[model samples]
Target chain A: MIWVNTIVQGILLGGLYALFAAGLSLVFGIMRLVNLAHGDLIVLGAYLILLLVTLLGLSPFVAVLVAAPAMFALGWALQRYMLNRVLGDDILPPLLVTFGLSIVLQNALLEGFSADSQRLPTAGLASASIELGAINVGVLPLMTLVTAVLVIVVLNQIFYRTRLGRAFRATSDDAVTASLMGIKPANIFAVATGIAMIIVTIAALYLGTRANFDPSVGPARLIYAFEAVIIGGLGSLWGTLLGGIIIGLAQTLGAAINPEWQILSGHIAFLLVLLVRPRGLFPRAVD
Target chain B: MTLINASSHRVEIATSASRLAAIAGFVIVVLLFAAPAFVSRRLLQDLFFILTMLGLAQCWNLLAGYGGLVSIGQQAFVGIGAYALFGTSILLGVNPVPAILIGGVVAALLAIPTAFFAFRLAGAYFAIGTWVIAEIVRLLVAQWKMLGGGTGTSLPNSIRREFWFTETIQDLFGVRAAASRDILAYWLALILVLSVIGGIYWLLRSRRGLALSAVRDNLQAARSVGVDALRMRWFVFISAAFGTGMIGALIYMQKARISPDAAFSVQDWTAYVIFIVVIGGIGTIEGPIIGVLVFFILQALLADFGSWYLMILGVIGIAVMLFAPRGLWGLFSDRTGIQLFPIRRRLVRPMISNDKREG
Candidate 1:
């Protein structure tokens, strides 16, 4: 029963990890930039949602509706103006540029809102849990998991079935070639970031609603997202979900065995996976 | 091959010139060692911080400059090393100094597999791959009970509880106790800074160095030229990991405590090093060193301005990329035909501009 409970909790936690990474994966899949500010952006998105919730007295779920597009626009403009300028053969420039951005965002958030962590109030939503015959699961965690699946499905559908998604993949494959074919690579990147930011907003909603968050929490979230992306593979959505689960499982199992082993165990799992298959479990062949 | 002509061309210009740089290094080291005797102790502490940043810059140079892997996740190693030192010393009953090395090795071991996992990702995948791995380690660490979980881990307040072999400095230098501690920190930082720079220089000067550059400049071409791109990259990756890990250990040793947030802060690792390298110049030997100096000075001066400093760094990086993409050191290289640490050879040619241009 303890094992079952841990697995259930792990699966739900995996959802949050998947959400955290979805934006990062999408951006990388479209444009080969690993935004160092990814985690910060998620924090920023959460902050945006927090503001919406505060101003309108709306629930966190409704607040996301208002914040997602706003965050999307912020992401779009940022990529269009800042990130696009740095994309090139030399990786140092883009990495450096993003690093600067990360510091700026972190400090900005710190200045605006002191170092004290803030939590999104969900009233009883977080505490509310339904007993499923043999076990009970928190509403927040279940929602996070469902939302993770939904985000993945929507992102996948967009990537495969939508024209913009086609453009995104094309740009990812060959930016120069995509440009020659009359698709503006920069615009595609902006749109991809916009979409990714929307996902970030969703991730942020869950991040804030489910747990305590401060300005400094972005990097930790970024790390989890990064692990999720790595475990799944570079460019696959379903793979991200699985990756999140793997990490979630590793942590929970590690915790079950010995609390200290939790973090070490996930890293060990990551290393073991690398030792066996370095390209990740489901790397996109074309990529 | 005109070996005679080339040797003669390099003869007057190379060895005698390098002597000056070597002398400068000696003088700098001497002045640095003596810094605690004259300067305010607080200033000495700041200088020590500069040294660690310098070491970080050098590691960045080795990774992005020599190895061709531009990593944004180096902080993960830095944080891990910090925590590893703390963990080993606090948890496992290891001595602090040895634990620093132990921390570094732990970071190195972790990096070996991480490099393999991340290496498969080219361009962004690799960058993101490293970042993700770091994040995973951090998240796991955050939840671990023994390591202070999310709140963080602290060490003994007094570093004096650790070993002390520097009694000679107390008698001769007149810089005692706290000042002497600063001196030790300064020297340790200097040693790390020099060692990392030296390591990178040595690596680049080796046959493997040529392969590293070949892989960086052009992977397919290097493969055709009999360079084992994969192995060369992996080796450099591990070397970078080891160096970064040491820096992390040193960082925690000085800072005296390690938290999940502080240990694995991506912002410091990803951006500051990147900024230092770019502002100083990426892909050059002295770039990170110069970059670190300039950046640290600016940081000490302007960190109080908070967001303004960040804006300046961002603008500087973007401006550097736009107008001076090569970096500060790169600009210097272009202006004067001088290189203190020559990684690439530029054979002297006759001043027959017209003939060369026509050809």
Candidate 2:
């Protein structure tokens, strides 16, 4: 019974990992850019949400509504003015640029927030848990998992159902041909990054509410998010979710065995998965 | 026998500027080597920092700039190398000098498994995969109780007594054991910088260097032309790890302390190295040499500003990537065409060439 409870808790935790990775996956799917700053951007989003909640006295949930659009604009501008300039034949520029951005974001956060850890005040929602037969689950983790699913579902709808989705697909397939067909790859990339940032905002809401965060935590989250992306395989959204679950399960199970092994277990699980499926469990693109 | 006579045509690999620069570089290195005699211990420590960082930057430039590996997790080698030195010295009672070499071997061995996993991903994903490996190594190393686990441990006082040159330097220099130790470390760092620079320059001028740049520019093209891409990548990756590990061990040995956090710090080992390479210029031997000096000066000037200094460096790195993608040395080279270490071969037609007579 206790083991079952741990498994359930692990699956719930996977939801948060998936949330952290969804934005990264989407950006990469469209632009083939692995933003080294994605984790820092998420941290930036959390701080933004924290700011709005504190300054406006709004509920944490409502603060995201205000922060999301702002984050979208920031992402859109970032892609248009910076990332697009460096996105050609050589892979070094974009990688280095994003890496520099990551350092800038992390240090800026430290300058602004200091080295102190901060958390979103969640009223009693953080401590609230519900029972399911022999197992119990935290409300925050449950909500996080549900929100992750919803975000993926909505992102899928935008990718397949909307005209914008067609533009995104066309541009991703071949930028020159897509541009010849009246689709602007730069604008599409900017829009895609904007949408990714909105997802980041949603992920930030949960991240801030569930745990304490400091400037230095972003890089660790980046490693986890990156692991989830790789385990899920490149360009596969659903695979990312499963990847997250695998990592989360590894961490929880490892912790169950020994507290010190929690993070190490997740990394080992990632390596194991790589050994078995080098292309990820659900590879979407042939490339 | 041939349409173009051998004596009439020459392949030139060095320019007048490069020849002059080579002589100047020798003089600079000689001065640096003798600095401990005239300089204060404080100055020696600072020079040690610059030399060690220059060595690491040179290694990274070889991997990323020449080989196109673009790894962001080089701290794995650095941390593992440091830990190996500490572990062997503390546990096996090995002398710290030889232990530094063992650290290099361990780091090179670790690279085999790391490459196995990281090579599965292409380009940007490869960068992230390496970072994951580094994190895994850091977490595991933290569990070693003999190394003081998470809190970390310092080298024993006996290490100072046991260090190869400490007493020799103490007697010769008439300084304290600690100052003599610093002087010895500074000399090691100077030697490391010279060897790393010389080794890289030699490699870049060799046949393998040509293959490396070819691989960097286009993997498929290089393979199509009969270049063994996998072998090249593996060779460069392992060599880089070995050099980086040795430097890591040397650094920690100088500090005389080892914590998983300090040993494995991504910011100190990887980020700073990356920044140095980017701002210096990725593909050239001269870039890192220039970049390290600039970095040292900037660091010294901004040491008091804390995070703001890092922010400024980050911004500078981004700006360089955007506007002058080849880095400061690249920009200067483009304008002046003055290569201090020329690798590009120019074909020169002699005044008595058959071509002139034929035309």
Candidate 3:
């Protein structure tokens, strides 16, 4: 029963990891550039949601709706203006530029938000619980898990079924070729990043409502998101969720045993997985 | 006769430029060697840090610039090495020197496995793979109980207690350079830098260098010419790991301590090294050295500003990537074709004009 509880909490935490990583996977799948600033963006989205909830006296869910689209625009503009310029044959440029961007974002957030932590007001919803047999789960955490599943489903639809998705796939396959086919790769990239930003907003909603966060928290979030993306095997969205669960489980279980083990266990799990399957659990065949 | 005259003038300019570059390189090396003799204690210590960064940049350059692998996780090896030295000496009861050697070996061993996984990834995937491994190691090391879990572990009692003062000798000739921990570290870093560059210089001049360069320029063509891409990549990757590991151990030796966060800091190895290599230029043996010195000086000058130094570094990194794509050393190399440490053979033929007579 205790083991079940540990696993349950682990699985629920996986939802957060999944949310953090889905946006990253989407961006990476479409554009071969990894945004080192991803975690900061997620934190920014969370802060945005927090602002909306606090200022407008809105519920967290309602605040997410408002924040998501706003983040989308930010992502679009960021890619079009800043990130797009750095994508090229030489990988160092993009990596260096993004690293600089990460520092810039972290520092800018530090300036705007201050180093003091801020959390969204969840009231009793955070304490609300759903009872299942002998086990009980926090309503907020359950909702987060559901949100992650929904985001993945919706993103998968956008990627496979939608015309926009086709354009994204075409662009991902070969940008120059896609441009020759009249599909503007840059616009597609901007849209992908925008969509990723919107996902980030969702992740932010959960993060803000669930725990205390400061500006410096983003890089750690980035590590989780990065781990999930890699563990899930890069291009596959659904696989990312499993990866998140693995990381979440490793961490929570490690924490259950010895609190310090929490962070370390996740990393150990990540390395063990790498040792076994270098391409990840569900790596893209081509990738 | 007009064409001949023009060619002759071009020859004169190229020869003079090469001559000037050789002179400059010679002077720089001499100055660098003489730094410890002239500099104050603090400045000399700072130079050690600069040398460490230079070593890292060079290792990164060899992998990314020459071998065409863009790794963002070199810090994993660095952290591993630092901790390995600190851990081996304290935890395993090894001497500091042996501990550092073990750190290098540990990095190499780690690299073999990491390469197995990372090599599966290409381009962006490869970069991400490296990053994931780095984070994995960092996290695990921080968690391991024997190593001092999350809050972090300090160096063992033996290692901490072991930093003996260098015997002071008053010599008339050259101050005999008082040997202290910092000085010792500085000398170690200097020797490592020289050896690493020497090894790289030799590597680039060998047939293997041709294969590596060929792979970097054109993979398919290199494969057609019988250059095994995977083999070259693994070799370069392992070499980078060894160099990075040695750098890590060297750093820890100076501090005489290790913290998981500091040991595994990608911020120092990946971010700073990338910044240095990018500004000074990437791909050349001497590029990273120049880059490290320039970055260190900037860092020192801007140490007064709390966060402004980071902003400046970011701005420089961004600017260099945008405008100076080939980097500072690259720009220098292109302008004059000066192979300061010639790893490649250049066919230099005197220009013969229609009117110019052969000597």
Candidate number of the best TM-score: 2
Query: At residue A52, what lDDT does model 2 achieve?
Result: 94
Interface RMSD of 2: 0.7
Candidate ranking (DockQ, best to worst):
2, 3, 1
Candidate-wise lDDT, in order: 0.80, 0.92, 0.82
Model 3: how far residue B5 lies from native, Å: 24
Over B1-359, each residue of candidate 3 has an lDDT whose tens digit, in order, gives: 12333333321123454467668867877787766666787887788888898888899989989999988899899999988886777667776765777888899999997898888767765776787788778877776677776566666554644544333322322343334556667777888888888788889888899899999988999999899998999999999899889988988877765777787777777888888888888888767877887898898799887566877888888788778877888888888777566665544556555445533
TM-score of each: 0.84, 0.98, 0.88
User: Cα RMSD to native, each candidate?
Assistant: 4.7, 1.8, 4.2
Candidate chain B TM-scores, in order: 0.89, 0.96, 0.85
lDDT of 2 by residue, B1-33 (tens): 345677778899999999999899889888988
Candidate 3 stretches with Cα past 4 Å from truth are: A53-58, A272-277, A281-285, B1-27, B91-99, B143-165, B168-179, B335-339, B342-344, B350-359
Candidate 3 Cα lDDT to native: 0.82
Poorest lDDT segment (10 consecutive residues) of candidate 1 chain B: B2-11
Candidate 2 or 1, higher lDDT? 2
TM-score of 2: 0.98
Docking class of 1: acceptable
Candidate 1 lDDT over residue span B269-333, tens digit each: 65777888888988887788788888877887897897778767777776786678789988988
Q: Please state the CAPRI-style docking class of candidate 3.
A: medium
Model 3 over residues A1-287: C-alpha lDDT tens digits?
98899999999999999999999989888887788889989888888888888789998889989988899999999899878988876666777777777877776777677889988888788889989987899999899899899999999898889999999999888888989999998899999999999999989888888999988788789878888988898799998999998999999999999875688688778778877887789989354
